[model samples]
Target: MSVPILKQGEILIASIQSALSDRELVELRDELADRVGRLRSRGVVIDVTALDVLDSFATRTIRGIAYTAKLRGAKTVVVGIQPEVAFAMVQLGLSLDGIATALDLEEGMLLLQRWPK
Candidate 1:
């Protein structure tokens, strides 16, 4: 399913409501990249609370989104990563190194707000 990206002031928020296929995940990465530039956003928050699993591809894609947005002059924070997902990622040797993350959307927004532009 296509994820809905909402623009909130100078930040863009993409809340994933369901599990997405690989292609859809890539589409999200691309779309967020484009929107960051087009909208001149200062930050981005991607909420993946609904996702129960994050395979290598999904993990990589999220990291890519953060990096790409950073290069485009916007900070990115991933939020809503469940406890199970975090454990699974560690077990699978997956990491979101150098990427910012928060426990939920509200915290994600606060992080972005606190960071220097």
Candidate 2:
């Protein structure tokens, strides 16, 4: 299923509330890119707290999304990562290198706001 992306001021928030297939993640990446450009948003927050698992493909897709958003002049913050998911990602060496992360959505938004323009 598609995720809901909402805009709050100059930031776009995408809450991933379910397990998405690789194809769905790709679609999400494209949609976010389009929306960022159209809305002239300066930042994006992706909430993945609901996700119980994050595999290699999903991790890579998220990284790609962050990088793509950066190229479009938007900073990306990934938030709401559960402890178990974080452990699994670390064990698998899926360190989301270079991507900013926050403990929760609130902190994520704050990070985006504090980020230099």
Candidate 3:
């Protein structure tokens, strides 16, 4: 997996590419956590449009990613969940409660733009 960061002022969109598998998710959790730690946080948008699935491990990783980003002083928003991936993620019993989610990148960017730096 690859995490490509796109910066626009106080916004940082981390576009994740490739499948988010169990082992890969672990690596991402650590790597993304470190990346978040190093950033002068603003807001984070995880663009998972390129990913094909969202299993339990992947869901956990995302939650980890969000928490880690928050620790770095950034609000994390997950975006671009495909229909199938959404269904899978929901089936994993992951709650969106306090977490933010967007159907597409455009909406994600808009929301991220509104977040406080």
Candidate 4:
């Protein structure tokens, strides 16, 4: 299923409520990038709290989204990465690198707000 993306003020929040295949993940990346520009958003928050598994492809796609948003003059925060998922990502050598992340959606929003305009 397609992820639900919501707009709150100048921020775009995409919350993943279920598991998604690689295609869906890629689609999300593309759609978020498009919305960032079209909406002239100042930040993008992707909530993956419901996802229990995060493979390399998913990690890469999320990082790509962050980069794309940055290029569009908007910051991106990936929140809700469970401890198990983070451990698995580390075991697989997957990393978010330059992307900012938080424990949950609320913190993610705060992080975005603190970002320099």
Cα lDDT tens digits, model 2, 1-117, are 399999999999999989898999999999999999999999999999999999999999999999999999999999999999999999999988999999999999999998888
lDDT of 4 by residue, 5-111 (tens): 99999999999999999999999999999999999999999999999999988998999999999999899999999999999999999999889999999999999
**Candidate achieving the largest lDDT:** 1
Candidate 3 lDDT trough over 10 residues, lowest sum: 32-41
The sequence of per-residue lDDT tens digits that candidate 3 reaches over residues 16-114 is 887655776667667666666666657778888998877766777788878877777778888988898788767878655577999888898788887
Q: What is the lDDT, from 0 to 100, of the residue 19 in candidate 2?
A: 88
Candidate ranking under lDDT, highest first, comes to 1, 2, 4, 3
> Residue 25 of model 4: what lDDT?
94
Candidate 1: misplaced stretches above 4 Å?
none
Candidate 1, residue 43: the lDDT equals: 98
- For model 1, residues 1-117, the per-residue Cα lDDT tens digits are 399999999999999999999999999999999999999999999999999999899999999999999999999999999999999999999999999999999999999999986
> What TM-score does prediction 4 earn?
0.97
The better candidate by lDDT, 1 or 4, is 1
Candidate closer to the true structure by lDDT (higher is better), 2 or 4: 2
